[model samples]
Target: MRIAVALFEDAEELDWAGPWEVLAAWARQFPEDDVEVVTVASHDGPVTCAKGLRVLPDHTWETLGAVDVLVYPGGVGTRRELADPVVLDRLRTLHAEETLLASVCTGSLVFAAAGLLDGRPATTWWGLVERLGELGDGVDVRPDARFVDDGDVVTAAGVSAGIDMALHLVARLHSVERAREVRRYIQYDPEPPV
Candidate 1:
């Protein structure tokens, strides 16, 4: 499976990195699975992320020929991307072509902006849940889900939540055993301290 994680200027690092780590670990541990994880951007260049982290994209939208899945990560930049017709149109096209579409944090907002979440249950950063509903098209915004798997489109809430979503993707795409193995290899037994 080929997974393309979308990168953009001002994108939240963890939103993409969390999932990348999980997926990359899976690929490393299970080379037989043929899982390829790559970061894609609008252009083939370095993008300055939300917290001023520079990320070099492995491929551009033009070069990412046939991606099995697309992972869109959100950030402060999503506010601007929400208004970009080009981005929305491209996302819509990708949805039509890709087998599965996943979003992290406010990435769902981009999906909503692209009309991908229309008439579907989805989730995003807690603070923007209401704003997501306001986007209309009958989006069933779930305010409490760490992630919502509504068929082809799966949305993860906030940043760290993306790791959970990625593992869920592995379980769904491969097998429960494979997912568990990947989790074990990554030592991703989360115990968040309040």
Candidate 2:
């Protein structure tokens, strides 16, 4: 599975890192699966994360290949990304290609803005569900589900939820046992905080 993780200026670090860590572990555990996880940004160079951390993209949006899955992470930049036509257009393009879409936290706003969440059940950070209603009717905002699976599109709530979503993706793509093994390897079985 070729997964393209999208990053832009001010993207939340954990939203991107949580999934990346889980998936990177999955790749390490099952090297034969050939699951590719590459970072892509609006531009072709380094991008600063919401925490002021710099991340270099593996490819530019225009050069990304056939993506089986697209992951968008939200950050302090989301309030501004709401008006970014480039990000919205990229979301449109990825959705049009029928790739599995996933988002963490306010990243759902990008999908909502791109019209991809229209009539699709989804979620985001606890308090931001109201803003997503503008995208479509019957969004079925879920504040409790760590990750909501609505077929091709899966949305996770908050930052750590991305880890759960990644394991979910592993189960979906491979097997439940494999997902369990990966979770065990990462010691993700214990929930320390509510």
Candidate 3:
């Protein structure tokens, strides 16, 4: 299975990186599974993240082949994507091809703008629940959910919530036991001190 994490300028670092860590670990630990994780962007050039982290994508949209899954991360850049017809068309094409679509934070908003979330259950950054609802008519926005798994389309709330969503993807694609193993491998035992 080939999983592509879509990157763009100003994308939140953790939104994509957290999931990348989990998925990359799975690919590394279980090569027999034939899982490949890669990052792709609209262009071949380096992408500057929201916090100024530079990333060179593995492939450009034009160069990428068939993908089993597509992970779209959110950030200030998503606002621009919402208005870009090229981005929206590619997303629609991927969905039509039955690729599993996952979004973090405001990434769902881009999905909404692309008409992918219409009449579907989805969520986004907590502060943007109302905005998501406004973006798509009949979009069932879940404000309290860490992530909403609506079968092919999974939407994660906020930034760090993407890690939880990624773990869920591991369980869904492989097994709960495998997800547990990956969590242990990453030592992701979160206990917020706040």
Could you give the C-alpha RMSD of every candidate to the true structure, in order shown? 0.9, 1.5, 0.6
Give one digit per residue, the lDDT tens place, for model 2 in 1-194.
89888888999999998888788788888898888889988787789998899999999877887989988898888878878897788778777888999999999888888787788789899878888776656677777778888998899998989989989999998899989988988888755777
Q: What TM-score does candidate 1 get on C-alpha atoms?
A: 0.97
Per-residue CA lDDT of model 1 for 100-188, tens digit only, reads 99999999998998899989999999989988987759999899999999988999999999999999999999999999998998899
Score candidate 2 by lDDT.
0.86
Best-matching candidate per lDDT: 3
Clash pairs detected, candidate 1:
none
After TM-score superposition, the amount by which residue 21's alpha carbon in candidate 3 deviates from its true location, in angstroms, is: 0.3
Per-prediction TM-score: 0.97, 0.93, 0.99
**Cα-based RMSD of candidate 2:** 1.5
TM-score of 2: 0.93
Clashes of each: 0, 0, 0
Task: Write candidate 3's Cα lDDT for 107-164 as tens digits.
Answer: 9999999999999999999988999999887999999999999988999999999999
Tell me the whole-model lDDT of each prediction, alpha carbons only.
Answer: 0.93, 0.86, 0.96
Q: For model 3, what is the alpha-carbon lDDT of residue 106?
A: 96
C-alpha lDDT (0 to 100) for residue 189 of candidate 2: 74
